[model samples]
Target: MNVSNLLKYCALSMAIGIAIVPNANAITPDDQLVIGMSMDNLLSLDPAAASGLDVVGVNSNLYDMLIELAPKDPSQISPAVAQSWTISDDGTRITFKLRDDVTFHSGNKLTAQDVAWSLQRVLKLNLALASTWKTYGFTADNVDQVVQAIDDYTLEITLPEITDPKLVLYTLGSSPSAFIVDRKEALKHEVDGDLAHTWLTTNVAGSGPFQLQNWRAKDRVLMNRFDDYWREPSEMKRIVMRHMTESQSLRLMLQRGDIDVAMGMSIPDIEALKQDSHIRTEANTRGTLYYVAVSMKDPKFANKKVREAVRYLIDYQGINESIMPNYGVLHQRPVKSGLPATLPGPGYALNVEKAKTLLAEAGYPEGFQTSIRVLSQLPFINIATNVQSTLAQAGINAEIITGTGNQVYGAMRERNFEMLVGRGGGGIEPHPHSSLRSLVYNPDNSDEAKLTNFQGWRTAFYSPDINSIIDTALLEKDAKKQIKMYQDVQNLYDTQIGAIFPISQMVDTVLIRSDVKHYEGHQAATTRLREVTKER
Candidate 1:
């Protein structure tokens, strides 16, 4: 049979509505984009507090950063609200020249003060996104003094410590915390001294292409195109993001033309759709990693030999081949793949006998029982099941505990979990430090530090040596020396058997209608909808 005939045959066999009469729920093309994906991790819309890829995608359309990492080439920085910027010879200060033409959705003129205040709000609030700035030595006390507006269209930032100016620039262009908020509008709704923290949870004060019409938590988010946008208005008249958790439902909706885009679909469903002529799948590899982490607070896991045993228990080859297709590729390193500084993975493979011997050496010859906290979603649950099976071979009985993103990660944030199957580590910025900062560099190991932003801290895994290496690497001016220093950090991490073991590098796959034009998925999760349009 021809490809078209096969598609029809397959659709008819499945009795999908698209083969006959479309469902009433099917959306008709009206210059609007309808997307289906899970919103469980979308806890906060406030740029300072929002913590997941869902909110990052949402905020991309709702706010504009000073600069942007070009979607086409993330290595290249693209100007947005800021027209141009210059770094001081000492590499301690950066001055940005703002565009005079930009205005917020509230019709307030975008200015340097707005940029300064928006950045300051992050440190002042000290929320989830403040970790990055804090690492750069900016604090609530120093923020006002360092990040200031020299004039209405000129913003200046003085780094509180000696570090790469590019890191700060990358943070400004890519981090959601760097997105500029309308200072005047936010202050108008400020309750007490929150800087509109409460209001911004569900509202927006941005200069991006779309304005939030309504955001019903865990249900749907509706946004309309901002007609007075600085650039060409979004081709989409409105964007509707329906809160969908089921991959099967998303696949069905996409097959029936009910939604223009579907994210977070199951591998089987995604593979099934590849034959459908009307749909196409786009896979974008992000900087994040899917890792199996252990808390060092647990005496059993704190042992270096035990950590190595746990590493040997993972079936890296099997998982990447059978379980990680369309999800991720085998990457057994802290830093993500493809970066110039990122060394090849240590090439650790699953060796059940080796794990058994290591366990015996660690005085766990009979193995032990533990619990693994994992997100209750596709890829995660599947990966956990595989890990559980492999761990059982080494006599480690791990009870699988599943929950939503908030539940699983919240436990990790509280330093309350024994083991976890999770995905994290920054990939938004092109810099190698991005991943190391999130996954390896832990300045504080004490629980009192409450440095929940760093997964390294969350795992209670700290090496002063590793931290020092990272600090020195960031300040190194020579390109070759910096790369060598990063490699040395990874070598030390492997030798020390860090608490977190990378299994695979993340690859986000989304299915979209063939006619959905200009929908580019970003490695940073900041996929913009401004230029997206539907041919139908």
Candidate 2:
């Protein structure tokens, strides 16, 4: 269906009431516990438009997916709405059998139809949502069709082509692209497409364990336990999420016992938290990589030798030791640093002498000048300062520009900067296609397909051979073939197309009050309220 029709249907659906107000005294702070976090601020409450930590926090409380990552074992998926799933022989179809008992917080039964409708909504409203489908090598446009209601509990998903393991994993994660919303309820609210964007910006209704009760943007959000939650009931009756923008304020709140958990603290703050006996710290390897996306389109960086020289000049080891001493781990590959069989091979080895030679070969005997823009957020500022100092030692004159996240993202998208330092989150898929699509597949222009081509990366280095290898890897079902193809792509990325420099995938450290419990299964700073509980 066209987007206009979809919008009309959504508006009609939302007009019908889906929410059932809870008893006034059913939930209260006295019956629950509070958690604290540092949020980047949310642009919208709808999972489709969610990109920041605040948005994630809000969505995690309000929405539920068919499948969820098991808390103890992230690789072992578990049932949320869908109890079990089976793959077709050709791996082209995935059939998910929904749990019979699950219902939305609004009291409507969640069925196969809802699941199908949710996926369709994401596919239909692609731009309003995060660009996660790029990793699947299939945008929402590629979802050939979704058939459901085979007895209400069975949902069958038919893709245009064979499904890859990485795609499967991505579809089950907490990412915005995977969240399942109530179709009838969403439509009844008069929110369809972009119009629904504003409606969902601060309101929600879903099957997740927690239900949002209040949201004061840039301040705090309050959620209470969903009494009709299909699974085990949450331990805390309510959860208070205080958005303390300043790290110092968060630190003070934690010390005063005003909050139970504090997330995304700086290295120094984490170190200080360790001194308090009442606080406990947990760190996990984030599926994220910090890198400097250099503009290959620039005349100076167009040469492969120049790109290699820039990569070699980065002293990742020293930066980690000095800036992120306790929480950082050097990353060799774009994948997370701690995953099994995901390490970098000969392609990522560092060599200063080789860098100098490459620089000289690129006609930069004394290196060249470039501007590096960085987000003003903590840790990023420190990291950029370190990068500036390190590049200077290689005779490269680097200057740092600071701006807000939105400003930086816009600048990168507009190709206004020489280099941009940022992390490309959500590359959990093992295949190179997952990373390649984001960096290479530009829907707007075949020439500028890679998202990283933001800095005018149009060059002859866009190799058809590398693209073929990535495509083969995506279609390859066998694990061995996938790895080989991935290796080929990495080798190409490292040696030929010098678009990005791989930095450390540092651990995201979170501090929880000793009295709090049930916060587990976080691979990074990203947390799901469904899996967390506060001790009384």
- Compared with the true structure, the alpha-carbon lDDT of candidate 2 equals 0.63
Model 1, position 359, has a per-residue lDDT of: 91
- The numbered model that scores best in TM-score is 1
Clashes of 1: 0
lDDT of 1 by residue, 286-367 (tens): 9999999999999999998899999999989999998899999999999988888888878899899999999999999999
In TM-score terms, candidate 1 sits at 0.94
Each candidate: how many clashes? 0, 12
In angstroms, the error of model 2 at 189 is: 4.1
Task: Return the top candidate by lDDT.
Answer: 1
lDDT against the true structure, per candidate, is: 0.89, 0.63
